[model samples]
Target: MAALQIRQDYSAPDLRQRAARERDTRASLRLLAIANALEGMPRAEAAGLAGIKCQALHDAIQRFNAEGPDGLHDRHRSGRPEQLSPGQQAALKAHILHGPEPERDGVSAWHLVDLCEYVERTYGDSEWGLSGPLKRLNLSRQKTRPSHSNGHPAAQAAFKKGAAVTAAEPRGTAS
Candidate 1:
């Protein structure tokens, strides 16, 4: 069987320059390295210099031959689709930003679990997890103790005075 060879080949220096300039991805560089090697060396040696398997080099060479530099790019992978659409995500963000109504939202503040449940009920995508949806909505967990409408300023001052006294007291039989 004949070894695969690069066609419409650029010179080694040209390939190097093109590889670096065409795209900045690792895949592109690797492809360019293989192409560069094939310019002056054999297929197996080219693959070795590129640190890829011969089969991979062959495939890349085929792609390069067919589509030039563009074929060397990483192909798009069909990842999991968004559980919520753009409008739905916007609505969710607004819902969070508007703040949860204690009586209406059934909770004082947003909890991830509660948010997940809300998403399930509101958007019908129960698969929505904490991090992904929160990131998508540009939301983060804010740690804040709820302030009471009738919080006692006097009591707080008294507590601070007592704390200062305690802190000032000599420890372990002074001097």
Candidate 2:
């Protein structure tokens, strides 16, 4: 196989300077490797000094030749596609924010299990699949503590006032 040639436009010193200024460790390594290659070091030795494989150095060289210094940096990777469409996600977000209808949803508040089931029934997706979308939407699994149905604010305030009064009153010594 023919040895890949390092671009002559960028000198070894220039590449070293760029490597020193680079924040990304991987990109810096690639720059260093190219610099070593530019200085007449063998491909395998150059890649080893950069803590990378010869193949990686070759790939970096190709990128550098094609796009110059900018090409040495990693390409933006588009990860796995979203399961739900934008409209569907928006609907889900709105549904979550508006809250579950007690009559229709049969729940006073939303829970992960409940939401999972709702997603399955409404979107035809599995119950397990809602977690990732919910996370992406920044919806937390944690729910607010439920208030007691029988609790009265007035009664609780009165009890607290009475307790405070009792606590403030000094106890008399036994005769």
Candidate 3:
């Protein structure tokens, strides 16, 4: 197969300058590879100098030919789509912020597992995990310590006061 030609009008020095100015490391490497190629360096040597494969240099050459220096930069990639719609996400966020109802949700506070189950039951999204969604909604996993239902606040305060008084009392010295 014939080697792909770099149609961009930049000289070896001009390409090096562009590489120097490029903020993206990958793009700069591509630029350097093209510059070395323009300077009559072997394809393997050029790619090695740029720390990329010969095939990568070939691809870069094709991109340079088609779209000039701008094409050397990586294109924006749209990753995996969200499982829930914007409205559903908003509803989930609101539900989290409002907190769980003890009588209805069967819990005093919202836990990650409970929230995951809630999403599965309410939103019919069994695959959804609460961790990432909660993070995106600015919700943290921290919860206040649980208090015992039968604990007496007054008695506890009295006990603390008695302990403090006993601790402060001085002992008699032995003669």
Candidate 4:
């Protein structure tokens, strides 16, 4: 197979330096390394230097030639679309800010399941979970700390005030 000629616009050392300074993803660095190796070496050797297969080296070269340095970076991909519209999101945020009341909403606190039901009933059918909405709204659920069942509030306050309370068995007797 005929060896593909690499463009001589930049030297291998220059490419290597640029690759070192590249702040993007690791794939870009690998592409730069491959481009540098291809400057003088054969496809197989260049691929080895870049720790990629020959096919990948060929693809990288084509990308580099067509789009220059920018082509070496990762391509943007569109992920799953959001279920809630802008207005719906705004409404949800407003509802969350209003908070829940025991007499009105019939709950002391808003739970994930309760929020999910509320969204489904109020906004429409939404598969969106609580976590995503909570993150987007920058809201967090308040949690209550566990307290001892037998703890006495008045006795605790007295202890804090330096009240001298004697032990049940007294300090001197072991029995």
With candidate 2 superimposed using the best TM-score fit, by how many Å does residue 164's alpha carbon deviate from the native? 12
Give every collision pair in model 2: none
Residue pairs that clash (backbone atoms under 3 angstroms), model 4: none
lDDT of prediction 1: 0.74
> Which regions of candidate 2 are displaced past 4 Å?
147-175
What is the alpha-carbon lDDT for the whole of candidate 4? 0.73
TM-score of each: 0.65, 0.75, 0.75, 0.64
lDDT of each: 0.74, 0.89, 0.88, 0.73
lDDT winner, 1 or 3: 3
Candidate 1 RMSD computed on C-alpha atoms after optimal superposition onto the true structure: 5.2
**How far in Å is the alpha carbon of 48 misplaced in model 4?**
1.3
- What's the TM for model 4? 0.64
If both were scored by lDDT, which would come out higher, candidate 2 or candidate 3?
Answer: 2
Q: State, as a TM-score between 0 and 1, how close model 1 is to the true structure.
A: 0.65
Tell me how far the alpha carbon of residue 131 in candidate 4 is from the true structure, in angstroms, after superposition: 1.0
